[model samples]
Target chain A: MIERFQYDNRIVKNFLFVTIMWGVVGMLVGLTAAIQLVVPSWNFADWGSFGRLRPLHTNAVIFAFVGNAIFAGAYYSLQRLLKARMYSDMLGKIHFWGWQLIIVSAVITLPLGMTTGKEYAELEWPIDIAITLIWVVFGINMMGTIIKRRERHLYVAIWFYIATWVTVAMLHIVNSIELPISMTKSYSWYAGVQDALVQWWYGHNAVAFFLTTPFLGLMYYFLPKAANRPVYSYKLSIIHFWSLIFLYIWAGPHHLLYSALPEWAQSLGTVFSIMLIAPSWGGMLNGLLTLRGAWDRVREDPVLKFFVVAVTCYGMATLEGPLLSLKSINAIAHFTDWIIAHVHIGGIGWNGFMIFGMVYWLVPRMYGTKLHSVKLANAHFWLGTLGIILYAVPLYFAGFFQSLMWKQFTPDGFLMYPNFLGHTAGDQDGLRTARYRR
Target chain B: MDTLLEIKTAYVLRVIGGSVYLTGAFLMVYNVRKTVISGKLIANEDAEAPPLEKMDQAKESGHWHRWIERRPIQMLVISLIVVGIGGVLEIVPTFLVKTNIPTISSVKPYTPLELHGRDIYVREGCYTCHSQMVRPFRSETERYGEYAKAGEFVYDHPFQWGSKRTGPDLLRVGGKYPDSWHYYHMYDPTSMSPGSLMPPYMHMFEDLLDTTTTKRKIEAMRTMGVPYAADFPAHANDHLSAQQDKIVASLKKDGIEAQKEMEIIAVIAYLQRVGTDIKAKEVVEAKPANP
Candidate 1:
């Protein structure tokens, strides 16, 4: 006998609501940080200084905004893909509330300057323990559902999902191994070059697994569904998944190029990072070409427009990603605003757009009503596209200008622009004013 | 036709390699089962899908990978092995190979006062803007005196060689300015380096260094392979006071004292300690003429 069960979409709805709330909060923190960069006086007391708030902004965005979006999408899609409700409603609630509590803890701790000083892995020991526990709960819930899945074929999308969970767990555990000195402070297990290597291995891949893989899963599911078509090529996707996972892991050293890290490891990172373009494009092509017959609908449908831009941004970033990893390019671009511009290209364009598209496609269906304003959604799309362009373009110009001035040595090997170019072209106040109401 | 044959040969080799890896993994799993499964099986109250007995018949007709997919346990284990292999390969070698980090004979451990100041630097997140790693590039070397060597950071507990460079590198900033420059800069950064984007570190002047933790921090450093001289921790307070008094005298010459026992003193001590090891000989020769 076949038993039917309603998908526990209430959990999905709760996560989706939290997504909007956290997105607003995270973006506001980020906006404030950008403002502080331009107007140093805006830095409030010690707790509200730019240095403290910068980590808060990053944590809030990565673990809060993007984190909640992943949960909402995963909960909704996992149930439907397996043709079963989540394995346990109790576990689902635990995962949801537990994650929120962790984000709340971060908000309180990071602003107080209680950090391990590692980027992305900045949360102190107690919070790190909480993260590991919550991650296990999430893993058990996911694995439980997959085991009891009524479907026969595990889709390529699920491959990405599985990789996301496993890689993130490994990254988090390895990076969070710190010796605590106080309630809110700790030291990394590794020091000097070793710490840099390990942190970037965790740091670079945090972007790969946390930001990239899960969203690729979302793209696989939502892009095809919205376009009313099947995927472009299943064989290509299979190739894309395996090659990406294997290649991405070796590319972390690219972030440490021309630094104190050993030359061999740096070279390894560059080679693998460059090779990543092949699989990245394969995934991008799969999404874009899936809308083969449905391309006409893109003009009217705001959701499809978001997916198109998202896929295109994915293509641009993946292409630029490899180019940036080249030793020649890295020598100049490593610490400059160019890297910031490249990251925002991926962050605002790819991840932000995908989330917006998913939210728009999902919200009405969950609420059992059509969208109240398609015109407003269209407005958001243009405004967002324009906003990203305005934010990224000026920084690219400034990054190159600053880099050139820094590198412009006289024939006698004295710094050419040391006294003349007194002020750095590093003013990024342009970023503060015009972000998408993200 | 020749290229096609080569491709087929590569594919066959891959099949052989993959099978060997998987078989070894399966043997380990079986070995664990022999030890644990015979002891006890935990009662799992989990819902499970009905098995498809048609797998053998359908293997010739259906997607080959689906057989493993239907068994989530096998799939999860396989995924774990694949992802786990890379981390093991990269990290194990780094830890085992002592030659990866070449030591410098001249490099010495931080003093008690300097150690506390380094910790204060960490607390301030100063690493966010001012990087400590001076690369071998001509631009970097010209701007910041000398290139950094790996062994120079042997005693930096968690290594604050920050990735970005919003400000100038600080690895070689020692002895570059008078004591008064740092004091005025901490009070108001714009006063010293006009148009600099750095914020004033005013609170550091008010907050006294926590002398209680100095002994514990020194002991911790010794445990981390930092070679502190014997009796260093016992006289840590005395050493800190002597260092503070010297800094106060130096600042008096410049007509300012941020505070004799303040956190600012500790940070100044740490900053002055940087890049001084290579210059120790020159300093000793010129010490009589410096003041």
Candidate 2:
């Protein structure tokens, strides 16, 4: 009665390559955007301006790079965990090529100024449709594999993957509903406050479903395997999974606090966001404790080192997310680089590092050869860690500075930085002069 | 027996928590090692062992078990519960709390032309960069004049309330500028305010305003509970013409000449209407003293 099958590692390998390539590209764009903030004139020209390219950089990294990486890891890990081959390799390829096409389209369209102007969901209707189709292909492929899985009693990671797939589908479909005035332009089906609600609901959860959950799934699978241990607690995994999913959705309204969203909704967002800390840290604790009695191994292994740092960063980001969701704290942090720093902690440290570790582990097995160089990987690891610190620390200072200056009042009760332009550009010239001296 | 029981209980919890945590951690590390230690990844030789083979057989036998299959549905129901509860909590209050938004007597809905102009503004992604809602904070009051109340936006179909403050709030810009000033500003933002970051809307002047959708838009607004007169759409053109005449006369009074058809004329009308209702609450005209 035994059934055995071979997983298509090739599709996973393809996705892994895309993840690395896009990761580098996305980070470069992010670095460029960061520089543009300090030196506004760097890419101030019409086509290359920060406004046009910011979306490009974000989409490139989030969707093109990190997104593909998530798919690669998920598919490869899921099949092995379930003791099955993928349900459809053809569907997998279609999903892969379709996603890449969408990324290409975004790269071209956003710079051309053909945007609906929603953050994260910036692609116009056509590209949005393409994303939807490709997403469905991925869903079908994933669901098909699950249906044919040899394992009963789906693992905690599979639960997360299911939630991610369903929730992302719901968020994308709901938020992308627009009445097109042109091929490239459209109005949201829900306008005004309703639109704001829907957009943030999708936006915040996009981080949750698209960014957080799948990565958590990856962590669950790869972490135990790396440390050569069974999962620490099955019951806690169940609790963490359900609690995180439930609390995460309501936390979206926190992004709209003190804005036009109803006060009650904002309050709901705050309450749920505060509640999120329990489950979030539960998962983080789960991740870290998996390495119990392996501290020595961690010191010797760059993979374990990356993972340790990644989980710790996850803990930091989850804690900061709830704190930032608080109205009082958000007053200072909202729209500032503090939010940027917080996000990168997750992006670079948690998601980026974890993915890097995953790729390092996966590539060798697939290639049927020893790694080309452990030293190179260690170098990449150190450089990446340094890059994250260099990128985030300055932004933290900048965010704090911005908040203080914006709120600063003159002796006569006028704003100390009254002119918005002046406030944004304050001391730029001086900074530039100092840079030149250096 | 008690000491053994206590130690056993503690050990159990620690193992549970620790194993879960370790599993999470190990997976991430394994991923890295798998990539770094490039060599023939020896597949688990035990993966083909007899006990695992039996477990795999048992798994296949019950793989389609209904209870096992229902997990995704259960997860879906839970997801729905979370999102649904939040939605109801948010929607119920905005619906029930009529007293939360006290009405201003002078606050009226936008006329057809003004509504069209507002749509145009939204189309150009102005709200992405500019905010219209003023918070109750002291800084907001001093900068934008008069804090915004929920009632002010009651008639707004999709509230134009913005999230970011990259540009100043436009809540109180009504009647603050002459029509000619708006004309020049929209045509070329730098012409009016030096170093203004707002993009010019020069195309507004050349693009013929699409009034064809005006009736439909008004009808949609009316359906959303705005108290437009039943004949409002039928007389929409008449009202638009009258509004344009009033705007042109006001412009001339300020030594500004403008044709009624100019896009600036409509945008001026929209801007001039901002924060006018709040003026009735205070006897003091809240004008910039230096302007």
DockQ of each: 0.12, 0.11
Please identify model 1 stretches exceeding 4 Å from their true place: A419-438, B1-60, B229-231, B281-291
Q: What would you estimate as the lDDT of candidate 1?
A: 0.76
lDDT of 2 by residue, A1-438 (tens): 555456687788778877876766666665555454434445544455556677777788788877997899888887887777778889989998888889888888876666666678878899988888998999888878767666655787888888888788878888887766557656566544566677788878888888889989999999888888777877678788878887888888888788766777889899999999999999998999889888789876777778888989899999999999989998887765577678878877898888878877777767677566666666666656666665566556656666666676777777665544443234332232324324
- Candidate 1, residues B1-291, lDDT tens digits: the string is 222233223323333332332232233223333333333322121234443234454444555666665666676667667667766666666666877778767778888889888877777677777788777898888777788876677777677887667677899888776677777777787675555567888888888888987887777666666788767888888988999999988988867744688888888888889877867756676889987
Q: Alpha carbon lDDT of residue A25, candidate 1?
A: 74
Q: How does model 1 score by TM-score?
A: 0.88
lDDT of each: 0.76, 0.70
Candidate 1 residue A357 C-alpha distance from true site, Å = 0.6
- TM-score of the second chain in candidate 1: 0.73
lDDT tens digits by residue: candidate 2, B49-119:
11133333443443333343334557655666655565555645654675545666666788988876776
Best-fitting candidate, scored by DockQ: 1
Question: Which TM-score value belongs to model 2?
Answer: 0.78
